[model samples]
Target: MWHLYQFPLCPFSRKVRLALGEKGVSFEMLREHPWEARDEFFAFNPAGRTPVLHHGPKGITLIDSQAICEYFEETVDKSPLILGTAANRAEIRRLVALFDENFFADVTLPLLHERMKKRLVLRAPPDSKLLRQAMRLAHEHLDYIDWLVDNRRWLAGAQLSLADLTAAAQISVVDYLGGVDWSGHEGSHGWYRVIKSRPSFRPLLSEKMEGIAPPSQYADVNA
Candidate 1:
């Protein structure tokens, strides 16, 4: 069986989880506290981040959620979610970068970790000023998504790809904290309603923090 080291609330880790579920692959889930930076965890990936995939066959570790997802989709022939052509792959990669870069840095990280870090005292609190800037920037990113969603069913394209999974993971985390401006961006709002409504999204929605109660809709899948 494969092993995935992840945290309870990291969006990057959720990306890998969604990919695994979409492929119907079962694996062991090991919860890791990334802030502590344990030596055993570092042995798997020097970056010392969560969501590291360990393939039992090769006993090798893969860092980065996107890399792990692509590896599984490419090497495992069961159900490939990747695009057939190089051009399609480029678009997928672009969408992934859009989420990992601007969406994450601007929206999820700031709203959750910054304004709400007090709820999770385990890690060092995020910078206050950066958090403020992140909130402003996130609205701009959401505005961009609103425009894109006006055209396509999915964030990247017509098919439900890892790009949707990527955005779902990020947005879901914030949704848990009641951060999304659900009424402002109808396109994005509708898209998330579908993505989060999926059967694969169940486990993510079911997740709950020790002292934190996700808004009632966090588990609704339809919300």
Candidate 2:
């Protein structure tokens, strides 16, 4: 009986959704447009962000994707998303930070602001210059991911961790905007394909935003 307020395209929200699905936790998803700053939503989370979770069993509300996912890991204890020994956990957390902070800062946020948030929420024209910059940075981020997957089985290491879900959540949003050029990044593309094929990822792949058509390959695991 968990309730999650989330925007379909928001990476942070998507990350939590992926985590919940991967862990076999069922919850109700309430679509919220945070830009509207609804008062009811604010009552639940003062920060007014999506991906806020209401844990029915404990009657506690959780804000922030990182906190919610970690709390689920600690409470659920079924499928281990963040696995391995202390050192391995450290590495996994490092990569999680890399994508959640570094990748989003350089690529996801900027691109979404220009291509999505501006037009859909703000009702403003896209910034061409910023869009171009974000596109370039997106490719660089992809290259970095290619390098990482080239070395490790997953983003962090052999086991599938939060790092993989975190990175995929962000990248999938960008890919929906046609920002990802998956032609050359063979390693990363293959890794993504594997993740995309998972049953947990099916719901996300089926999502289609209003007035925004994703690329043909956006939902294709074999693409």
Instruction: Score each candidate by Cα lDDT.
Output: 0.79, 0.88
How well does candidate 1 score on lDDT at residue 217? 74
Q: How well is each residue in 92-190 modelled by candidate 1, as lDDT tens digits?
A: 789888997778877887776754565576456657687667656766777877887887777666788888888888888877766666667777878
lDDT of residue 87 for candidate 1: 84
Off by over 4 Å in 2: none
Worst 10 residues of 1 by lDDT: 114-123
Query: Using Cα atoms with residue i matched to residue i, what is each candidate's TM-score against the true structure?
Result: 0.90, 0.95
